[model samples]
Target: MLHTLCNVESGRLSRVEAEEEFTVDQLAAKVGMTVRNVRAYAGRGLIPPPRLVGRTGYYGPDHVARLTLVQELLGKGYTLAAVERMMSELPDGAMALGVFQTLVNPWTPSEPEELDELQLAEAAGIPHDPAIIAKLVELGIAERMDNGHLRIPNPDLLRTGLEVIKLGVPLDAIFILLPKLFAQADAVAKTYVELFRSTVWRQFADAGLPAEGWPEIQRTLENIIPLAGQALVAAFREAMAREIEVVAYEELGLDPNTLPSTG
Candidate 1:
């Protein structure tokens, strides 16, 4: 008698020993995608391709997870090319921002360990200027505590400043830009707050609460913060491109002084 793998009543795969490595067929089955689709994604550079285990190509858990994300993003109107760019760019931007944060605003080790202006300057490894720090405080990106120490209102404000700088905008321009830009961001954040509060937070509530929420919060931020920044920047890039085109037209004014008018 011959038998095939079948799901019992739960309609889920039966619990079994999880494999550390999986073959192409197994990976395709696990990812709920076709073998051709997997190969196409690899060819298109949408994800890191599977590792070669001697004669057979084997995929690890990371590949499976990435494949799932790729599939979801594709279904949500993300083109393969865009998805590929996003996949690679997210990590690159995150790593770059991490370095920038270390330079600009290394987090204090713990509470009750406040930074005076001098220590803050030393920790950030930047030249000190009371005026500039005052400007940041005025922007509400930082604030003075009751104890006469400066504190970051939120670390993300520093990260966002670094991201703006990473886009090649100068520091003076950034100081000008962030105030306006972050006002826009405040409106943008409301949508995501609704999304998380309704969906993700509810799901977490259903699951047993862990010893600490910070670890889960950090993991979620790792996924979200970079992606949110990328989305905002893509919009800004499009807007700037349009602005440049218009500026070029205005700069090349059609006035008789600048252009040869058609007679």
Candidate 2:
């Protein structure tokens, strides 16, 4: 008996713990594919070659699973090239996007808490207003449940916004400011993603992305997810410090050259 492994989120499937093996025709019949298509997929390196035994070849559960996945993706309107790239046989574009989407998380990871409208306002130190609640929903900060409860996706973000509100920034200004800040963050994230696309992934693709090389590539991608955030924070802090010094010199009649030295 063969056990099929389904990774629905990533659109990948594999079979394991099976001793079942089939010839080309049988393999195609089992997966509801043609012999020619199976051979074509094998040629494209979409599926690993069948185990060789003398002049004959035998396909196993892995082939069945991979071919099934390909059929499913095709049925769902994936281009053949897109599928090939996902399998790392063709040049990567969408494939890289999918990889990064899986690897990267833009928001900070934290436990979410549910709150009612009144409780949410208490938490954020804001008044309970339906208009403001609508704004929160628009900003994706809270979700309106069927029962009128609001779901806070990121409580830390709520606390941060509350602190900004406490610092004399008007609620209306916060709304306007958030979109611009998000746009800047999007641009920064794109830069880092493109850097990976052009440098790390391109080199890997050029090397034929061998079976043994995947672990290293995945590890590198995982490392980039956190490192990009850390690098961005370090870069932003230095930029902010310089901007503050210049602002003080111009607006506050302070000596920029007399700024406190870190050393």
Candidate 3:
């Protein structure tokens, strides 16, 4: 039988097989593990033993979750013994599963898109500059696939770069400025991430991350994702306005304070 559960991060309900049963082979297939590995995990006490009915054994959702968690931990370079200790520390069932899901599911603004060579060149307004394309790839703006196609990870950023190029900015100048912009953006991102880490995540950890509060914590993170962008834009505009005024006063000798008021 299929079951439904709340997707805490998106505030949407997702259908998961809560009570569905699986044979050892079915469980291995379901969790993308080999049967031998599944048996080893069960034998090693890394996961709970299946329920035996006569000659057959059945696995459930909790077993699937535990196996997934183990796989994720192993993928991250944790030893099997370390993974066992980590799982042993956490409370079973919903609490462990919720925490794992939260860690695995990050908030992404949008999906990446693939573009042909001609389309990428048109977007960047550099029709035949192999050097510019190389620079873009080096800067992590886009990636060149094995098939020679390009994948634009952040289309909005690419479009913004194209707009600047359309303003007659020299390619060399843009390339130099792009790295500085990225560096500054990285610093800002670190500050914002630290803010969230110190506040919300810290509180969650301090409270022992109770299962009852997982949904609320997830909702808070979801709300923060967009709100953080809005806040950054608002702050940047204000800073830019102040800096523009200062630059005009120094370079063009035009002081806004001394100008006659329009009113």
Candidate 4:
């Protein structure tokens, strides 16, 4: 009787239908759980019971979805107690989605400001190594202007190098790591760009957002790129630390208890 009512009335119910028309058995079956277990979960306040309308009960799809969600979390190694707390204490998915948008979305930069080559070098504090400059010039990293001034061909390389200057590593050592690091950043950037192109663009188009919103969308994504890049670097650093501190330490004949200054 309850199954037939659910089938007949499911289409009539709003997205968040009133919970006064569902029974414990009906909700349990919807989430593939038994009635007694559903009742036990309700008793423990892990799942909320349906509303009672003069002894007839109903639950919305949100209730059914929550049950399935909890089951999935448990299957993914979360304790029932943890799932219960998460259900009670956590905000809805929309909140997390909003945060992801804020974090991952690109933000616009202020209008472009022009800085000349000399200004760029001074701002970046290019070391006065005439020999290195000559090598860079030969390698096409820097170029000579017609007016006899030197110019940086790729400004990002100079900026990234300046940014890492305070890390206490020698320039030669840093050079070894720079190519691989930039390559990793480039790969991660490509992934996000592809995601925006394939997924976000389609989503925006389907939602009928204006074409003018594209810049704002790209800005938000660009803003997110640095954050995502930093996150990847942090994760890599942890993994590298584990390998260097533990795995390689024993092979180097060092005591783990008396590890060298990691600082």
- The numbered model that scores best in lDDT is 3
Worst 10 residues of 2 by lDDT: 1-10
Best-to-worst order by lDDT is 3, 2, 1, 4
| Greater-lDDT candidate between 1 and 2 | 2
Compared with the true structure, what per-residue lDDT tens digits does model 4 show for residues 26-51?
88888899988777877877655666
Query: For candidate 3, lDDT tens digit of each residue in 41-117?
Result: 98878776778999899988878888988897896568998877666554456544665566555555567679877
Best by TM-score: 3
**Per-residue lDDT value at 59 in model 3:** 88
Per-model RMSD to reference: 19.1, 10.5, 7.7, 22.0
- Full candidate order by TM-score, most accurate first: 3, 2, 4, 1
The C-alpha TM-scores of every prediction are 0.34, 0.59, 0.66, 0.37
**Candidate 1 residue-wise lDDT, 90-190, digit = tens:** 22112222322232232333333346777766654557889878987888767787888887756655766756666767768878887787778778766
Clashes of each: 0, 0, 0, 14
- Candidates 1 and 2: which is better by TM-score? 2
Cα displacement (angstroms), candidate 2, residue 85, comes to 16
Q: What stretches of model 1 exceed 4 Å from their correct place?
A: 1-133, 141-176, 202-222, 254-263
Please identify which of the two predictions, 1 or 3, would achieve the higher TM-score against the true structure.
3
Q: Report the backbone clash tally of model 3.
A: 0
